[model samples]
Target: MKYVTRTCYLGQISILSVAITLTCVSPNVVSAATPTLGCDDSMKTAFKPDGNTTVLLVKKVKKDDPYPSPSKEQQIFPNRPARFAADLCWVKLLVGPGVPGPTGAPSTSRGIGIEVWLPEKNAWNHRVHALGGGGWANGYEETVVGRMSVGNGNLPAPRIAAEEGAVTATTDSGQQYAGASFAMNPDGTVNVAGWRDWSYRSLYEQAVKTKALATAYYGSPPNYSYFEGGSGGGRQALHVAQNLPEQYDGIVSIRAGASTTSDIAQLYPELLVLRDLGGKAPSREQLEAVSAAAVAACDIVAGQHLGFILDIRRCRYDPTKDAAVLCRSDGGTNGTPTCMTSAQALVMNKVWYGLTIDGSVPDPALDNGWDAPVTGVRIWYGYPRGGYIRSLQGDLTWPEMKSGGPDIIALALGNPKIGTPDFKNATANGEDGWKTLTYAELAAAYQSFRAMQSETGGDPDYNSDLTRLKISGAKLLQVNGLHDPSAWVQGLTEYYDRVMAKMGGPASVQAYYKMFVVPGMSHGYFSGAANPNANPPVPADGQLYRALVDWVEKGVSPDSMVFTSPAPGSESSVYKIYPHPHGPQMSLPACAYPTVATYFSGDIFKAQSYKCR
Candidate 1:
C-alpha cells in the first residue's frame, strides 16, 4: 500500500527554498493503525439498538488478516490486485430494504449490508472516513460497479483510512447483487423501498449507523469525518454532502460529472448505438483503435505533441471523418484490424451525440453558453472521444449491463410497470423509448424522474446551493479524469460552475470546495492510447486523500499537483493500493480546473516546463 510522506504530492516543489518550502500537506501518520476491541457478540448489544438496523456480526481482525474477497474484482480494476489496510473491530450490519413511509422498517424488500472498521484506539486519528459504493452498488466498485466488482475499488477510500488509523466503513447499497436489479419487481412495478435504499437511504443510514458505532467504540464521537468515492462512490459523496450536510465534514467525489448521477446514464445511448444500428458494438480492437485515432488527431497543441487531448470539450476530432485514417468495415463483423465500417462510424457518432433531440453533435464552441452547465443541449452526455475504450463496448461485458438503458429509465421514472421500455421501437409519444427518445421526450423523462424522486423526501441530484455545508465549514474536493469514458469532465465542470454561482462565485467555492480535472487520466488510470512519456495520473485515492486531510486538519489547500507516470513501460502495479513512488521519467503539473497544464518550451516530461494557464 502507498506510504506517501507529507511532502509527496505538492508537485515538484524544488522551485522554492527547500527548508521553508510549503509541501502543503501531511502524510497520514497514525501511530497505531488498527484498534484492539476485545469482545464478541456481547459487545454488539453494548451499543444502543438502531431502529431497523441489525449488527449481524462483530469480529476482531488482525492487521494483514485476509479480507473476504469479492467475486469479480477485474470489472473494477482489470489489472490491479486487492489488499485491505489496518484492522480492528470489523462490524457488519444490515439496514432496512424498507423505507419511504411511516413503515420505514424492514419489509420484504432487500436490505443493505454495511461493514465498519474501527481502528486501534491509541493511534486513531479520531476521524470517521465513510466510503460510498459504486456503479449499481451502494458500496465500492465505480467506487462495483468494490469488493471484487470495481478494481477492489481501485484500492478504495476505506483502505487508506483504515490503514492510516481512522475509522472507516463501506456498504453494499441493498443491491449487493449490484446495479438496477433491485429496482425491478415481479409484477413489473417499481420497488420504491429498494430504490430508496440503493439511491440514498442505504448510503445515508450506513453513515449514520457507522458514526454511531464508531462513537460506541471510541467512547465519544469523532472530531472530523470525510466521505470519499469515485464513479458511483462519487455520487454517494455528493448525496451525503447535499442531503445530510452535517454528516461529513468533507466530500472527495470523483466521476460525478453532470453533477447529477453516475455517468451510467451515458451507457444507454452508446449501447443503443451499437445494438440498434450495427446489431452489435464494434469488437474491442476497433473501439481501442478509434480511441487511439481520436487521441492522435487531438493530442497536439500549438504544434506540440502532448499525447492526450488537452481541452476535451473543445476537441474537434470527429469519428465520421476518420475515413482517411481507419480502414473500412461493414458495421457488423466486417471490421478488420484497423478498419471501421460505415455503420460502426455512425454508431460512434450517435454515441457521441448521446440522447439528443436530433442525432447531431453539439458544437464544441457552444459548450459554455449563457445557460449554467447549459441545460436542454441534450438529454444526457455521451462518452468522450479518446476516452477509455474498455469503458466503451466493454461496459456491457458485465452481465448486469446488457439491459442497462431500459433499467435506468425504469428506475429514474420509478415506474416498475414500464417493464423494459423499447429501445429500437420508441412509442409514438416517446414516453419510455430510451433509444429513440427525442430531445423533448428525453427532457420530459428527466423532469419526470426528478419529480418522482423529489416526492421521496429528498432529491440528491438537485439543490446545488450547499449554503448549509459551507456554513458548517465542510469542504468538498472533486478529482476527475478529463477523458473519463464513464464519467466525463463536462458534467463535473458544469456542477462546479453551478455550485460556484450559488455559493458566491469561484472564489467562495474554492475556499472549501475545489476540483482537479486531471488531463489524460481515464477513470482512475492513465489513457489507453500509447503515451509512453505522459505523466502518471496523481494517485486519486492516495494523494487526494492526503490533500483532503491537510485541508481539514492543517488548513492547507492544494493549488496544483505534480502527476507522475511510470517510466515508458513500468507502470507501477503493486498488489496493495498504497501510493508508492513510480520512477524512470514521468512528471507533469496538472493545474486546478478553469486552468489547464499548458506546454511551454522545455523537457516535455518535466512539471517546470508546463504552465497552468
Candidate 2:
C-alpha cells in the first residue's frame, strides 16, 4: 500500500480535490534493481513457504519455449504464434490445504493451486502482476490440487505478465479439479470452503505468497504491482483492489463479470421468452436483422449516418413495433429473408427490456430484500442491442444451445451450495430444463442465488467499498466495449455510479480512477464488421496497459481512448491498429464516462473528426 514519493506540493486546491493532492505524490514504482536468483529446485527450499501454503514445483522455462506450453503445441497456438515467453522461473503452490475459510466454513480436503512465473534474475522487473481467471476458472489448472475445476478454465493473464518482465501468478481457488462441480459435494451439500476459496480466500493468499516468493528470489520486494483482466478475470482484478489493496498499485478491469445472481437473473428472461415460443423461436438471421435495424436506427448523428450509436439509451427504436423489421404478414413492409415475425419481434422486445417487472435492472441489490421471491422483481438489465447478437442468437437453437441459463438456475437453486438433485435433474434433459420449470420454481432459485452472493459470487466483495483502494495511492482504469454482449455495459456503468456514490461523486472518484467505453468492440473477440454500415468490431490492443503504467508512474490520466477498426488493406496485425495513428487505420474517439465521441466533421474513419463532448 506504499509508494515511492516523488514530490508533493500544495496550492489552491478545489474542495473536490486534495483527491488530486494525494494523487500527485504517487508514482507506480522506483525499482531497487533487476534482481537475479538462480532458477532451479533448490529455490523451492529458498522460498520458505508459510502458513498452509506448500511450494509444490519450481522450474525454469528457457528462452524460446513455446508460449503457454500447451498439451499439444499446435492445438491452440501454432505458426509464428503468440509472444514466446522466455527466461522465466515457474512456481506452483498448494495454498491453505484442508483449511477452513472465514465464517466457520468447513475445511476442504483440497487446497488452492496457484502458479507464479517470474522472469529470471537479471530479467526481473521488480514488479508483480497477477492474472484473474474467467468463469469458474481461477488461474492454473494443475493436477497437484484435488478438485479440478467448476469449468476447468484458465486465462492468459499470467503468461502475458511474465512476457512483460513481471513476477506474475494465478490461483485456481481450489476449482482446478472439480470445476463448477466443486461447489456441490457428493452428498449434495454446499462446499463452503470451496466457495470461499474461489470467491475470496484464493486471491488474498496468492498475493501474499506471490510477493513473498518474489522477495525471496529478488532479494528485495517489488516497488509496484498491477493486475489486469477482462470478463471474470476483470472481476478478480476488482476484487483485489477492493479487498486486498496491498496486492496491486494499478488495476485495469475490463468488462468485469456481475454476480451469480445477476448472471442467472439476466439470462433467464431470454430463456423464458424462447421457451414460451414452443420451439418456434426466431431464426438467427432474424435476430441479427433486428439488431442491425437497431443500429441503423440509432447510429445517426446530426445529418451524418454514423457507424455506431454513441448512446444506446437515447436510441429508442424498439424492434417489436419497428416498421423496417416486421414482416408484411405480421404488419410492416420489409420482405427480406431476415424480416422479423411478430413472435421474433416479441423475443427481441423481451431481451431489450430484460426481465424486469418494474423496468428496473434485474440485478439484485445487496440487502436482506433479495432473500424474497423473485416473481415480479427486477432481475438485471437486458443485453444491450448490439454485438450482432452473435453470442446470444447462436445460443437460441436448442440443439446447439450455448447460453448457461439452465445451469445458472440449477446453481442458484442450490443456494449456499449446489442443490443435490436439482443441479442434475433440472438440466438433465438439456433444454427441457427450460420447458418444465415453473415460474415459481425459477423465482425461488433466483432468490436462493441472490442470498448466496456473499459466499459464492464476489457481489458483496466486488461491489462493496473502494475507500481502501482510493486511499492506497493506486489508480484504476476500467474499459468496456459499447457493443460488448458478454458483460453488461449498463451494469458496469451502474457499478461506477455506485462507487461514485460511495466516494462522494464522479469528481472525487475520477481523481484516482477512470473508465472508458470502446465503440465497435465486443468482449475482445470479433474483429470485423458486426454491422457493415456501422464501425466494424476490432481487437483491443495493449495500448491501455501502457496508459495504466504511465498513469501510475507519471500521473497522466487518460481523458480519451482511441478505438480502431482495420481499414481495408491495412496490415493484418493488431499493432497496426495500436500505438495510435498507425497506417490506414479506421479509428474512433472513445471518451471517459458521461462523455462520448461525438462526430464533428470530416472522414468518419479519422478519430480526429470526433470530439469527446
Best by lDDT: 2
Q: Residue 38 in model 2: shift from native, Å?
A: 3.2
lDDT comparing candidate 1 with the true structure: 0.57
lDDT tens digits by residue: candidate 1, 1-613: 0122222121222211222121222322323343423437875565543456677787766666554654244434455444455656667777653433222221134467777777777767888777765565542322311242122235543454566788777887765434454554543345555655666666666666776676556655677877877676777777767655566777788766233333334544554554555446676666766766777777776676666666665666666555654554442333356567666676665565455544454544344111234346565666666654433554424443333444456556544333242211111111434555544555566655555555542234555778767876778888788766656566667667778878898777788878887777765554433233344444433677677778877888766567666544333332122122232355667577777787777776677888988
RMSD per model, one decimal = 10.7, 9.0
Q: Residue 404: error of model 1 in Å?
A: 3.4
Off by over 4 Å in 2: 1-37, 67-83, 99-109, 143-162, 273-275, 357-377, 395-402, 415-434, 439-444, 454-457, 460-462, 525-529, 536-540, 567-585
Q: lDDT values of the candidates?
A: 0.57, 0.58
RMSD of 2: 9.0
lDDT tens digits, residue span 1-613, model 2? 3433332322222221212121122222215664434577776565554556677887766666655444211222244244345666777877655444333222234577888877777777778777666555442455221111111122254345445788777777666442344554444446656666676677777676777677767777777787766667677777777766655788877767655455555454445554656655566677667776777777676666555566665666666568788899889898999888777776665566555543233222221112322235655556565444533555423221234445556555543223322233212322334445554565566666666664344453336477877878888888777776666676677777788888888888888778877765665523312354443434344666667888888877766456666554433232211112123446777687857777788886678888987
